[model samples]
Target: MIDVLAPAEAIHAAPELGAVYLSAFGAPGYDEEPARAEEFATEQIPLHSQRDDFKLVVARDAGKLTGFAYGFTGHRGQWWSDRVAAAVSPELADEWIGGHFEVVELAVVVEAQRQGVGAELMAALMTDLPNRKALLTTFADDRPAPRLYRRMGWKVLVPDLGWDSALYGLNLGVPLGH
Candidate 1:
């Protein structure tokens, strides 16, 4: 089952999460460098955990970490938000950049792919976000991640934001219920 983790717990589990991230993205079809796994787990996750409204969720089966997803509220001055803001129009930046839940990473081990793990992770990640919407960037091709986002009602905000990536947005009307 997928369970949300408090920031402390997520930080504590960063090492294992790094392993899963490495395994998932290092597999064929992802362009990430394998060396980044350690850095992401040790540095990025820990730093991101300090952000406001940060959240992380991990899926475990038979005590093995199968997948995880995490994000935090986006704000001005952040590197990613700034870069995205610069490329997009003032209207898009105004509506979808700051204050949105920025989905930072979602990964599932190769063995867990195509089994609804990604979908479940996303649903749990966005179920009750304080933000009115969420955003992410993924490869601009017909990949599983992009397909899953589109399937879940995320619209394409920018066909090519940069680095061969596409920006996506989801207007989360009322966080599951009023």
Candidate 2:
């Protein structure tokens, strides 16, 4: 089952979360980078936890962390928002980037990939967002992550947003019966 963790709890479990992150993205070239995969798990995840609206979900199998997805409410002047805004027009950025939930990261261990863990983490992260919309960036190539995003109804907002990535958005209209 996937479990939601508060910011503090997520921080406390950073080692476990970092292990999952390393197992998921510890590919070649990543090791040569100064802020390598381990840094992401140790530093980046904790930084994400500092967001006022940060949310995290983890899937466990036999109590082992297999996957995770996390994000937070977006606002003007944020690093990600500013970067995306530069790649798109003001109107488009205003409509999609402003005040939306930003899905910063979603990853599953290699052993757990293609088994719906990523999908579940994504659905759970966006299911109850207070924001009416959500956005994320993924590799521009036809990778499994991007395919999963498309399957979940996310539309490409910027086809080539630099860094060989594309920006995507989803309208989380009023929930049923709301």
Q: Which candidate leads in lDDT?
A: 1
lDDT by candidate, in order shown: 0.91, 0.85
Which candidate's TM-score is highest? 1
Q: How well does each candidate superpose onto the true structure, as a TM-score?
A: 0.95, 0.91
Query: Which pairs in model 2 have colliding backbones?
Result: none
lDDT value for candidate 2? 0.85
Error of 1 at 104 (Å): 0.5
**Per-residue lDDT of candidate 2, residues 66-162 (tens digit):** 9999999988889998899999898998799778999998979889989999999988988778898889999898888889988888888888887
Residue 27 local lDDT, model 2: 47
lDDT of 1 by residue, 1-178 (tens): 9999999999999999998899888887775686799999999999999999999999999999999999999999999999999999999999888999999999998899999999899999998889988999998988889989888888899999768999999889933212
